[model samples]
Target: MIKGSIQEEDITILNIYAPNIGAPPYIRQLLTTLKGEINKNTIIVGDFNTPLTAMDRSSRQKINKETQALNEALDQMDLTDIYRTFHPKATEYTFFSSAHGTFSKIDHILGYKSTQ
Candidate 1:
């Protein structure tokens, strides 16, 4: 968890990695369980490993159907992708594959509706 505060408000950010490409169901369940631990105003962030686009080939890993489905699950959960929102440019890359030096925007900052 990434901890930070703005003024008097405290926020807890969660960093998660779904080990498998088809792990959305498990991930969503985990998020649901964790939601109770966080305050309504807390901010969640990290590498979800879910790709919002199949065309986002800005990395070595190929964006497959499972990734796209995971992205949809995140959307359905109402998680806001802060980086993409602030940076509309497609050149933004976050993760680098050392093997291929391919960079992709897999890292993200997501916030609860109350905090955002």
Candidate 2:
């Protein structure tokens, strides 16, 4: 977790990059690996490696574990997926696999609703 003060207010932020080469429970480990106090003020931002949900990807295909852990973690942190909330129906990809010829929206800026 990255910690700093903005205008005299303490703020902590997390940049998550789940292991693409790792096996199952990638997000679970990423979420729990941090050793800091992640309150509602903390902001989570980065390339999560795994897409959070169907809307986060160009394909209509669903990703179960990724979605579940993302939602649960957000609930646990009382954070909001701001990008998704703002552009509900928009299709945007943060990453493109040149080798596989695919585009995916995996990176994100997640944080508390008040922060936005």
Candidate 3:
């Protein structure tokens, strides 16, 4: 977590790198911890490893526990994906894989509903 002032208003920034191997449990743990730190002025950014939705990837992927946890966390926290909030139908991506020959947007920026 980083603390600073933006336009004289105090803010908190949290950067994360969610593990792919244990994403389900890690997301659950992260959400538990975030419940205490997240606020209107908080911003969360990360490479979540798991896409929050099917549209976030270029290939068909099953809905897994990790994705479920992330989605639930957003609802419970009242957090919105900053990019998706603005460009709901966009097909942009942030990550690419050669071996799988697929593209996915695993990175995200999120903030409270009232923040944007």
Candidate 4:
């Protein structure tokens, strides 16, 4: 957790690094704990280890239940993906897997919808 002031407004930033596997359940638990701490000024950035949508992954495979749960949790918290908000149609990736020969966007910067 980071605390600072921007233009006289207090802000909180949460930086997270989730495990490559079993991230969805962990993220859900984390969000549940963060509900009381996060506000409109809060910014959450992380390597979530799972793509929130089909567009975020290079593969055309169906989105998994765990990933879907993560999206629902973020939506329930009113957190919007900062990059997607600014570039809705862009297809940028943050992670590449040589074994699978795939590229995915697993990192995210999220903020309250009202702030964006």
lDDT of each: 0.61, 0.71, 0.82, 0.89
Q: Predicted candidate 3: what Cα RMSD to the true structure?
A: 1.8
Prediction RMSDs, each to the true structure:
3.8, 2.8, 1.8, 1.4
Instruction: Decide which is better by lDDT, 1 or 2.
Output: 2
Please provide TM-scores, in order, for all candidate models, with all chains considered together.
0.62, 0.79, 0.89, 0.94
lDDT of 3 by residue, 1-116 (tens): 89899999999999889886786568668867768888899898888776777788899677677677768878888988899889898878888988899888889898888755
Q: What shift in Å separates residue 88 of candidate 3 from its native position after superposition?
A: 0.4
Worst 10 residues of 4 by lDDT: 52-61
For 1-116, candidate 4 gives per-residue lDDT tens digits of: 99999999999999988998898889888988989999999999999888877888899668889878888888999998999999887788999999999999999999998865
TM-score-better candidate, 2 vs 3 = 3
Greater lDDT among 2 and 3 belongs to 3
Ranking by lDDT: 4, 3, 2, 1
In the range 1-116, model 2's lDDT, one tens digit per residue, is 77899999998888777667542266556665652466667777877776667776666677776567757766675667788889888888888778767677878787776644
Residue pairs in clash, model 4: none
| Pairs with steric clashes in candidate 1 | none
Question: In candidate 4, how many Å is residue 29 off?
Answer: 0.9
